[model samples]
Target: MFNGSPFPVDAFPQIIRNAIYEVEQHTQAPQALIAASALGVISLACQNRIDVCRLNNLRGPVSLFLLTLAESGERKSTVDKLLMEPLYQLEENLFEKYTHDLTVWRNDEAIFNIEKKSLMSKLKSEIRRNKDHLATNEKLKVLLASHPKSPVRFKQIFNDATPAAIKDYLCGYWRSVGIMSDEAGTIFNGYTLNELPFINKMWDGAMFPVERKSEPEKLIRDARMTLSLMVQPNIFKGYIKRKGDMAKGIGFFARCLICQPGSTQGNRQITSPVVSTEYLPIFHQRLMKIVNESIARNNENDRLCLRFTVEAEKRWIAFSNNVEYEMGILGRLSNFKDYASKMAENMARIAALLHHFNGDEGDISLLTVEAAVEISTWYVGEYVRLFSKPQEFTLAISEADELYWWINNYCIRLKASWITKNTVLQYGPNKFRNRSKANEVLNTLYSQNRILTEKKGKTVFIAIAGSIF
Candidate 1:
């Protein structure tokens, strides 16, 4: 199998890049996994306070749904713990305040019930005696208006939850929260994902209603959720084998940025002076600032819609058009149409995430959007690599084909019988230069008899097949 490309860490802003570097150095986790963990933290802090306005004036959530596949000993939990330390710390503090508030609410409710009952009895007595009763009626109205209101319980993260429980929390406790789990089997293997369509709706920030036999119908609106899941490969495979039809039919997986990065185990050597866990404190400190600001403005009318600069909007329009055109029946991206369709909007979300995390002033800029495009393109390729059939053109196979086309073009244009490996590495497609992936593609093309590779002295040359030229 072809290995996935390393994440484009430099494309991210300095704050996020530092966090990713620190986490990867300290834990030796896959770079892509650490990047995804960083994104989840950004989503939790920004989703409630900010939104992204698309090129066409469409406003959407500044949230992301991420899924990472890895084995048991890949340090998935470590990445999550390091990045999400702020959220957990905040949740702990909130729980203490909630415990105290619950006590006060119970006492107030008891006093309210006693006063209400007394007024109700007094009203009946006054009515029976045919008295004026105006004073009693006024007292009852005042009493009803003064009825105690229980505090809205607060929580920020959950490993596993039912839809009803989620609605209750968002409606009563917090306006925004996240479903972050390292052992995602509890969510994927259980009933949480049984309602595939509901999960998809949650990702899109759509309105949801639940009808119950025992109570009134509930409508969930203006509530936001961000999901980051890390599951074992076998567990995810089983879920897809059993329920992929339903999930894919409803476009559940398309809403996610999915990856299964090659493992880095057995290579994390213990150095004499271990790498410092630096920048985590900075990550936490910056995130808590956003959290404090978001908490003060997590209402329906308070979201800060991040508009793109003029240059950024033009770039986005061009990108959307290009991707849409590539989704034709015979187009290379035809098989992964669902992902291509939503990728542009997700790119906008990524730009907003980076912009907010870096404390950039004013609107989202062209530079940020371009960097976001680079990151999104890599993940989309990863999605295709993981989901497409073997014979189908995976990203690696696509790179190989592009390289072969380049060789043929070079022969025709330059009148050269062959090209050097160094030339291909320096002057080929940007995706064609990674030595490991490039070598694998060369070997695969050779097995297919599609190209000829010749060695002369210290140089390697590639030429088209049937070299009658």
Candidate 2:
């Protein structure tokens, strides 16, 4: 999965392609990671304003949930910031405006309250003094109707948040939202697994009416959220280990476009131009233009529908049929029904985003749809690579590799040919301190010619293979 085929960057629009390449040159991260970040930013901005027609003929938000798997120091933060710099600036601008609006609302609300109190008192006195109470009552009614309401704070992105906090903000406070992180342990380990169903609803753009004990029950509609997380490979595996069954059972992982791109650590040689001053600024400006257009219109039900043209619709339907038929019992996609079924919709969504970003008029074209297909087909292949085999074996292989390195390092650092098994039992990795577990991993190393073990009179010793005796 880590060495999967490279993402189809050439298929992207020229505007996005240029920035991706620029980020790659500067960050030396995998292009796929950078691409995911770019798409996530687009999705977050477009989700509030645009709706695309899916195969079901129903309109769905052009939003995406992207999860990219990379190792530590893979420049996840660098890639995320490079793509989201424009959005960060937009948030700061919105916050400043909101602060001013809130202050004004406070003053108006206080005056409104004072007027209402005086009007009520006058109405009571008019009734007591046998005067015309109808005029005072009418005045009070007008004042009550004109009561000031506070401004709604507009915040679009959260680096990390819980389900409740997300609901509070995205469901009503802001129509569009995104939750992104470079190191995503806070998201994965912060009780997010328990709230998979909440995220699933957000992905489908389904209406969510939440029940509250102390507050009014809220009905949420026309809400959109995009989630993008870049986690280390180990944390990625840990998430699968803990919630694989629940996530698969409820089709949550199926809703995400998960990519495990290969690393580019040692290959980043210093180049003449260390940064991309030109391309990134251009991309940020264009991105800001798109986002500002969406927000300025205050589009709620007024959606800019991105439908497929005649030929593009045919292309999409053919792809959808092929995916359905390939999910048969004896079919190639039999083992991947959950993920394969969702890929075509994602293709349409991605195609719509590409079309709109390029400022194409009318319907989407077959050329754009084909490009989306190329990208989605690679995602199916990557999903199969990660989930085809039993995960237990994968975990074992990873542990074996770790133990082998630790053994070799221990032996070399101590200037010893072998280490006593008792020492391993006492001082090795915590999980391998036991006899049975240690042997399970040691036997794997032995079979791979990484280590040799000997027993001498009830004591066992292990040494790195090919070491001088």
The residue pairs that clash in candidate 1, if any, are: none
Candidate 1 similarity to native, TM-score: 0.83
Q: Per-residue lDDT tens digits of candidate 2, residues 380-426?
A: 87787777755467789999899888888898899889987778779
Model 1 Cα lDDT, one tens digit per residue, 146-166: 888887667878778887677
Overall local distance difference test of candidate 1: 0.82
Residue 368, candidate 2: alpha-carbon lDDT: 94
User: Which lDDT values do the candidates have, in the order given?
Assistant: 0.82, 0.82
Error of 1 at 159 (Å): 1.7
| TM, every model | 0.83, 0.79
Q: Candidate 2: which stretches are off by over 4 Å?
A: 390-469
Q: How many backbone clashes does candidate 1 have?
A: 0
